[model samples]
Target chain A: MSRRILNLILGCASVCVGLTPMRAQEFKLFERTVQVHGFASQGFIYTNDNNWLTMNTSQGSAAFTDFGLNMSTQITDKFRIGAQGYDRDLGQLGQYHPSLDWAVADYRFKSWFGIRGGKVKTTLGLFTDTQDLDFLHQFALLPQSVYPTDLRDATLAHVGGDIYGNILLQHHLGDLAYTVYAGHRSDSKYSGYSYFLTKYGVTSSSFAGLQYGSDLRWSTPLKGLLIGASRMNEEITDNGNLSLGPGIDFTSYSAVSRADWTNQFYGEYVIRKLQVDSEYRRYLHDQIVSPDSLETISDVRGWYISGCYRITKRLALGSYYSRYSITSVAGGAAAPFFPDQTDTSLPANHVYDKVISGRVDLNKFWSAKVEGHFMNGYGNSSFPDGFYPLANPGGFKPNTNALVLKTSVNF
Target chain B: MKNLRLLPLVAFLVLLAPVRARAAQVKIIANPSVSTDAISGRELKSVFLEEKNSLSDGSHVEPVLLKSGPVHESFLRQYLSRTDDDLRNYYRVLVFTGRGSMPKELGSDAEVVAYVAGRKGAIGYVSAEAGVDGVKTLAITDGRSPVERRVITRIEPEYPETLKRLNIGGIVRLQVTIAPKGNVENVQLLGGNPILGESAVAAVKQWVYATAPSRTRIEVSVPFNPQP
Candidate 1:
């Protein structure tokens, strides 16, 4: 009769309801092929110490659920259109907010050229756009250093356009794929950044920005070897209010990003049933916070190398070593409040996680995953890598261990 | 002693014969509506991969697949160079990404022949021993590496004046379908700036390729680098 149990039942029921219509992989509509697909996943998380991503994981919680439904149709030989709707409740993040993940009208004129415009997925690195299609990957969770779940909404898609195509290089050099895009980014109110800012007495009202990026990848002639690079530029502004002193003093505040950009490099190799992937990313944020007249600079560097092997048709084993660190932080007037912001050597400035995972495909459409994490640091509070100061008010331990069990069903 | 050694060699040859026969057991069968009597290895791969939809003779083609069988395994290994599971995963990706749809899958060689026989452009593969009475068997020629086709001519895409003035330059992708005679038959823009893609398509349409055994589809990239 507890509220937690009630919520769990309701969540499961909702996912079941969404999956009822996906029995037929696809159906005909007006003599055209209209495909319907959906996926739902529920996860249980438990941590030996410290809460993760706003979840009360110390006592174990099952407040992790996400689902998406999509339908696509090829209207013509060269024109296709599709849309996906997504919703998730991850601890205190996402908060069960439904979102239009992507709705694109894509037109392909040739194998080397195509254009899509609408709420389109953004292509950054190898997995940014495809992150929502979890079943395609072996690990329960992608490396937090590169593909953080907490920041999913921020980089998932954009309301703009993309031009993408694949090219076959001459002389057996290999194949190259390229995408260039420009779009507007609008973040949700229940996103991780919003919650993280609340702890600093900054309640963000709106977070909007303009983003443009280009991604180029080479599918080398060496069978399954792929290498790519991406560059993204963003201009964001967070409008909020700053809290002063103790009792009820608040002032209008704004975080104006002067320069924000990310550069990423990644490579993947697949030989037989074993696949290996690695990526390195550098993100720089320079902002001016008004009302307090503070200027802060944060330089984030993260990288991970992971490998997954399909031991059998139904089972897969994967492991990853991910490292995330705030290489530099310059908190002008806010240094006194957060001392670790200036001390780069402190454990609070970085997060190094080692994870091992196993997945079993119960059937063609259902899978279950068990993952264990051994983390060495909590990372900087200013940048949320699943750690929130408000969740761990008792302070964080130097090292923490956690277990995650997740099940996914898709059609 | 000599007879005993000969027995061992005979036994090895007997075991190897079946594998060799299985390698060539699959046959490509097409509906009578198809214009071409023969298909190259590269063209067969292109059709199955959903890259090229029409043959050089201007007949639209549709690929048919078997759910799973020895014939399916042999066709995947010899022409596609992919395992059954790999091909399935590839089709899944294509479907999920909205690039292509899954082909019609039949359970047995008889069902495949019946389906292809009834359809206009349907093509399928079956065991060589299967009675392909209604459908015609297309001989496979130039069974070279499926990825060996090369462009014999190149054309540079012109940068858009406005975009060039704005210093907006990037690579444009186009899918080019070439006829067996080596001339570009059709060009479609795959991805790039709209203006740049138009220019790329225009220029690529004039490019030619080395003579191929059959119609082939190849992706090409055109770069528009603006002056700094």
Candidate 2:
């Protein structure tokens, strides 16, 4: 026989011999269990205005298509590992990157507690952790007003070591389940866009921060109905150095309450607020704009109401209306950060936006969604400016309306 | 006058013969290895429903049931105070939730009797008239002195007949009192559908058994047959 055929035959014979019973009455030994699963999704997004779509920021709304692959495996009862990669084009910019999403060993003491040490993803809000794989959730895209960060980026989520647990309390008054986590998040400087900008001779900074968050959820059975309330808090440290002070440090708080009648009808309302303390620094061909500090404090408030109906066991339909507004206060004796900048007509920025979305679940692993956004106020645009090569665009014009359609799948 | 008197005497003897035979026909036996007296109906019901998985001696007990048909229906009604339909549905829910497994069903009373007798941990019920040897006949109710048959009506005058009809397939909860001589004295419907409640009470009252005294709660459903 050929060498390949000989090798194949030998392999099969070895496997058979390895599985043979060793003793006449002994129970079988040599156990093997293996499972393989993953998912891929790709979809196109178009914009009504090409210029709005082409705006460049860490994440911008541009018409493009993206796809990603994620695979995980349980090496044993206590250990799991996973990896994911995504390639996408947003308006004018394109990217292709792969990263380790989950590489952790979870030791579960009981049903309510576990300590996971390794690179772990933190789930804060309802859809915070699963923001990627848009196909798996109800919205075509994440709620931009709430999850303003890019879902495809690793820096937006958590990585590092975490200890998480849940406490369940049953009392005469009600039932409560609280989940809390404390962890230090670390990422390679290359995980953020600043690293790339810096490589291109543009002034940028490195970031590494600590995150601690907790969520308290309570549900009470009232006359055969379930009513629930939830509160969450997240705090992050300044991980970079800006000309003003350190880098932007922020604290976010969210509160939500919901009522569910049976498993069919449910309604929830959530409010989120973020406090940002940072400064704007100027650069002249990679030189500091000023030697003194120019501090800026920005605050954003957003909220939404959503309702969902499960039409069938594997199908559901939902709708949500949400709004977000941001205000920034600039302080310290400062000159126009960029003298070469052209759009000098603007003052301190503010933005207001409203979005209405509807979604349909096609299956447990897939969903389709469509949404329309009505933005009225102009705020600091997260776009790069053309006038000053180093000064990023800081404002966007208001009264822009756009519609989006998205689909996602997960395995 | 002489012929009429003779006819009356003969009628009395004929009626007494069947009653005597029925009383004599009742037999109780445990498996050869089992040392205890036949279980009471209440204990049997508890064992079959898994409310208790062990007997007084701490021996594990497993109940076998007929898969379907008249015997299954009769067994459930006589012991569980539930219709076969309701029992089957409840078991399905339990099995789905991993609470317990459905009892193994045999083909017929003969099979059920043989299986229960041969298996050390097995228990099952068959017709009082099956005349099967080896297996035991648990008393339907415990007491002595021919207990008066008392029909405990559960339905009010205003209950709908349709609901009453459905109650035939619904669960009937009853609290029963058995005398020390194995005679049933009183039964009260603790809960259940109002429609079939009367028939259930009536059927239970007519049940006769010979066993030790015991007071226990039981649920049984008596099915209605339009053809009968």
The residue-by-residue lDDT of candidate 1 on A1-411, one tens digit each, is: 254674587557645644454343678999987888777787889999999978999999888888887888877756878887888888888877898888889886665678889998888888887676667777777888888888887687789998987775665676688899999998998888888898888889998899889999998979789999999888999998888657987889898888999999999998888989999998898888886667777888889999999999899999999998885444667657544475545678888999999998776666788999999888855687888898999988888898998877777
Which lDDT tens digits does candidate 2 get at residues B1-228?
A: 765756664555345332222221122223544444446554566567654455545555667887666656656755565756446544532232222345656777788878878866677766444545876544333312223223333332233344433332333445566544545577676444434455566656656545543443332333333222
Best by TM-score: 1
Query: What TM-score goes with each of the models?
Result: 0.78, 0.47
Predicted structure with the largest DockQ when compared to the true one: 1
Each candidate's DockQ: 0.13, 0.04
Global lDDT scores for all candidate models = 0.79, 0.42
Model 2: per-residue Cα lDDT over A285-319, one tens digit each: 11111223334333444445554444454444555
